[model samples]
Target: MIIYLLLAIIIGYLVFVAIRIGLHQRLPLALGPISLELIPDRAAKKYRERPIFTIDIPCHWEIEALKTRYIDPLAWSAKRIQSTAGMLASLLQHQFNLQYGERVAIFKQNHFDIHLFTISIIRAGGIACPVNGKLSINDFDPYLANLSATILITDSAAILKFLQSGIDFGCCRKLIIAEKRALKSEIEVTALEEQMARSYPDIQIYWLEEALLSVQKESPAVPRGKDDPLYLVHSSGTTGFPKAVILKNGPQAHAVRGWLCYVHLSRTWDKGFGALPNNHQAVILSFNSLLLLGFPAHWSSSYDHLDFNAEEVMRALADGKFTGYFGFPVTYTQLKEVPAEKYDLSAMRIWGSTADASHEVIQRKFVSIGNAFKAFGIPLKGSIFLDAQGSSEVGTPSVIRYFTRYTNTFDRRIGRIGSTPFGPKIRIVKENGEKVKRGEVGKLEVKGKTVFAGYWNNPALTYQAIHGNWFFTGDVVRLNKDGHLIQLDRLVDVIHTSDGEVYSLPIEEKLHKHPAVFDVCVYAHQQPDGTYLPSVAAALKVKNSISNSLLLHEFNQMLEGKEKLCRCEIMEWSEFPIGVTGKTLKRVFRNRSEQMMK
Candidate 1:
């Protein structure tokens, strides 16, 4: 009997290996000409070797190239960035004295921040860096010196900030302030322009519109390649000083291609709606991937605006006929609050949730929408809701796990192997650097051409992050026996209690399930005696009428039998602060808790 069992086990292992190899061979053909190629001594490259067509949309101000085809040779040229690139090139050719390696800074004041300006600067062979317009004097001064920006292109607001901060314009040789429409009257406009001229006598201030009119529309082409520096994306300054993440063309192009394949954007029927802020990863995927793959995309001013009137979005779906949508868990929850039949969302083909993992409630809501579409006899295909596990450091696009059909079974093996049609290489490792057994939790690391090169500068930090060309995604995850990856929690968010116990995602997920809670953050509060207390801060929805005391009582009742949490560890409830990305700012909660203890 023992000999027969051993033979069966050996045969099972061989079958698994054969299946994995066969799937890898068949995937490219099944997914429409996508392949992963291993380059000899050049690192593994994953992309279509043949040139692929795409479309470029550079501005929100106009929709000119709505259905244009972007061929490879023309796309790499100066015109694809924006029409502004041609304008800047003309200015450089005529008015500005050309230097071999000069850097240019661009600032514009409009309700919507312009990404085209940064693209234009890169096309002009100039290093482009945009400063935060809202930063105080103390904050802005240090960053200015860090980049050593030589030219300034801004509006009155940025110029005024510079003046208020008493920053010497000696380093900045030229200052071109954009003409503002806010100065309504011609007389007022001229007077304001004259005043700016007088304020910076030595600095040259030229009207951008006037420059455009005088110069030719055609611009001299700037030579570029895969390794050219594209832009600097700054990290949020929540933890400490913000680091400038330097992104290059090679890695960025790889990311754009990977996104195109992952999202299946090459299909003519593909369309997406983006409501996340301009600076976040969702926008990056929507804009860059669309531009790179010729996919149609749309965006709202803000997610909050969309949440207020989700019917507007449904109306858009009916009018524009969108197929895909990307949003966070909070946005999904808001959609659940409204009745489904009020608007026609049957046009939606695929829906994605990012920034945070999808809660059970949100997943149920999505599954219901899918079921409703089918019930109405609309040809609405079953949807895909993915949990994207990656970081900004990993080129803003990385590993993805899709939940196509919602099930109560938490069998983590649903989508584990690269043998699947749409799966990437996944591995879970222990702290001492060994692959953990299946059904065990450990740090998750991913290796692919999709990963970012590294943080812009700060080599010391980058060295610590990327090991043997693999991006160490600071997330705790596990792979089940069925080969599916399950994310546990962020490494930093894990709370270590005084009793030497670790309580992580269970508390946060449980609190979020409460009817009174709209959102919640769980963290550790350290006492003067060095003992840490588990604290939970939450934001209750306006609709919930339960008092704080009742909410607390309900919470204690829920945790009575759970061995992971103690009764004494229950912290006070406070209003949760929100970030620009609409996530509950856990860092702010931790700070507030420390203040209360003091």
Candidate 2:
């Protein structure tokens, strides 16, 4: 009798899901004129009328801009974004001689221009490459050359960096400055332009304002087939130098369709905000998804992208009444300490995380603050925290987990692998490609429509990353007894102690529960005997009263055998090496520890 009841429940749930998905598919695509809002920007001015998404920065930055001049932020509305992008695309094609299929590299902080130029380049039948603006010139030089980019579009800060560093322009013949700025330290724009001319005489320099003057009528979008290359984005590069992943139209379109069916249509999200770095692939996905859904989406930033913090994000969410929020795990870490009473976040329905799985500790605070939806005219009190674990190569999330104020699941449980109909086909396989049994840890592999074509310009490395039809995700994971995916650690970061393999994530989770520990990264350190043991580097709270030794002792008491830390170092938050997409660079510390052992 119990078996029959269970079977009936499962079948009913499946039928309901099928009905929801089918209804979502029938919903019209690209419903017109989505509302877009912007938080106040200091360096922006209204260039056109009927601009719903005007730019404005924080008031503190406005005061600083008086001393040091800044560039004007880009502004446009949903109706105008495409038309303006069309004109820009026309300029690139006719004036700059940017041929179809050529690469146009963008080096700028997160703002309206990144999205504008991306769409413009796609419309022109060209591939858009957005480099991480936070990277130093030394780190940025290799990618510029590797891209063989025909055209380069950048902001004032990057222009200043290039002039100071004397970096080569590589294959790029034309450079377009996206904003007008009186160079910092009272330097004139013309003075910097003259310097650029002398330093890079072979490269033609064009100001964005001047380039837009020759604006042609909005040309019809250049037709593209499903497999045509759309963009080139990089992996997070936490382990090493980032790999350039090639994303095509077909895969991205498929992802959009899948999300629309299983995710967006099921939500009552009124306004949304994204705090993830604009260069990340997930940001582009969010931008596309919101635009198609006809939903209002807001992105907040100051003059300096890296300087934008948790406070600014909170301010935007409060002011915009954002119902849905998407960000990386690092962003959530920064927000964990921010008191709920300080910000009006009650309207938030969902706190969505991708790129990495967020800790339950972080989700618990947020989930307690808002209502997900109304039930029979009464609003529920708790929001949903949706965590999806995937990567750039996969193009879409493979595993998804959701936490509410009520969920009992905790610590490294990443939820189920794959979704209905359109999500990736996921597997846990040994190094030799054999499938792993339940509860056994193995490398995660995924096969799906949304996977990238390959790593750009590195076929040898790409070949190694794929086995038959499955793309190796470089993740060490296991299937739990409940059939959910449990994230152990990245394969490279797993500590191989003499006793056994110790996953860093679960150990870090235990440490994070302590009030004094602000942020923690647990990594493997090699001992004198060439064996590995877990070590910790942590940033503590400002008023933390606990001593390092006492904290370490407390942490160890929570752990059983092999996972206990060998050493604990209290470090400043800045001391942790972070990747472009804001993941901790564990390999750097691992390398340093190995050297110390040697």
Candidate 3:
């Protein structure tokens, strides 16, 4: 009897050990050649189970709802997003034969369907590559070739552009036409699937709308480990062809964390509005950050981005319903032109800018607009502006600093964009890897959770950008006495003259302070003598006139000794042409100035 009892005790002990081992054991999940570890939710777990996208999921505006003048009538609830994404994953994997690490290039703007498509691609273990719809067919050709995409999903506008150009979809095996439901009537909608099937007999074409509703298969998200590549985002090819950057899952998650930390989002504030393009990483990462945050923010409607409607956005802000607002500096430049007292913009508590720094004049104007409704005697409250200096590789802003009406101080300095984001450490380093002293200029480098993995298929460029774990941001910055980082210019933007190196941004930012100057870009022009002259082209405020001679004279007086320049041109703000992304084409202006001056 004693022997039997001892044997039973030993068996029970062995069973306990087996159960413990099983709990800790990790399995590697493989989709084709890519292998990922599905770790138990402990750290860096993004959007596992929470409300992500907000609204009715099967989001078609009812015939009655569509009659309303709401710019973007579609909203998607979280469960609807999941089920639609799951169905999409199944269809993409089974029908299109998409595998791990394969590129699926999508040409689209900001819309709920595009967001759903992106989630589906990642859930199906494929890289979602969103092409900038603003790029011309000639500019877009290399990206398609470089991607070697197995699938191409595009909108009607892109298709129309392709038809107008010599570029062909020879590289893509399958095509998806995602017609914008809201803008279908604006363009001449066609039955292109049938026409394309007839012309390209070898390739398959499918309509995105039909598939979303018809595909019944379910494939839930496979937990890809945090470090795996999730997206392939292209760089703005101002200097040359765009480099496709590999966005890793870990950094993608970090973007959500960084934004949450930077802007203290309130659970009560349910709606946030941003008019970013579909390709922007901030918009892409927001779809996943739903793990911690309660509700998803809404994107602006699928209207022509180049022709931005100020009223469409201002009306939304003035309605006093939204909790947050995000836009580019250029957008704010246009917004400040509208009278602040005309609208009730006080409801927007959290406001931020992503691309370029808001001109100090516009910065002060936004704070004033936020505080306009406060009683004349009472102090202002609940308005924050973020000068988020960011890029495609940094996941979110590498530098994030805020200015409130109560906290802001006037300091005449160049590149006062912001400071470090939540998880990254920003350092000003010299070429030799030494940290720069305060008040000295150096290259900006970032080390953190959100730095990108590398440039897609371009290891040489990747190596040049990242040293060890630190990614070298090509931006030039200096540390102020208060330890705040000031953006000077892009390394490429600085030009060397016979006198010395001249940073154009400082010259331009200083000039912008002049009452008559509304907007300006500074570039270097080379003369027949081979000496580079720092030059300025400025846009004058409406009804304010300044002559080119007087402008040059005033500009030269602002500079001392070696910093003085020989040329300046003053024109109306509308005269300065912008790129499709709405950035001033400084290189183009420099070339034109070179021709004119020479």
Backbone atom clashes (below 3 Å) for every candidate: 3, 5, 1
Steric clash pairs (candidate 2): 40-56, 40-57, 41-56, 41-57, 42-57
lDDT of 2 by residue, 125-244 (tens): 789998878876886788788888989998777888999998887898888888644333445777877898899889888777666667656555677777888889988887677788
Q: Global CA lDDT of candidate 2, please?
A: 0.73
Question: For every model shown, what is its TM-score relative to the native structure?
Answer: 0.73, 0.87, 0.81
Error of 2 at 59 (Å): 16
Per-residue error at 563 for model 3, in Å? 4.4
Question: lDDT per model, in order?
Answer: 0.53, 0.73, 0.65
Residue 28 local lDDT, model 2: 44
Report the C-alpha lDDT of model 1 over 139-225, residue by residue, as the tens digit. 556655555567776776676667656666546767766553433478756765576666766777765555555664645446555
Q: Give the alpha carbon lDDT tens digit for every residue of 126-207 in model 3.
A: 8888876777688687778888888988776676676557466757878777643554653344455445555666777666
Between 2 and 3, whose TM-score is larger? 2
Show the lowest summed lDDT stretch of 10 residues, model 3: 23-32
Worst ten in a row by lDDT for model 1:
35-44
TM-score of 2: 0.87
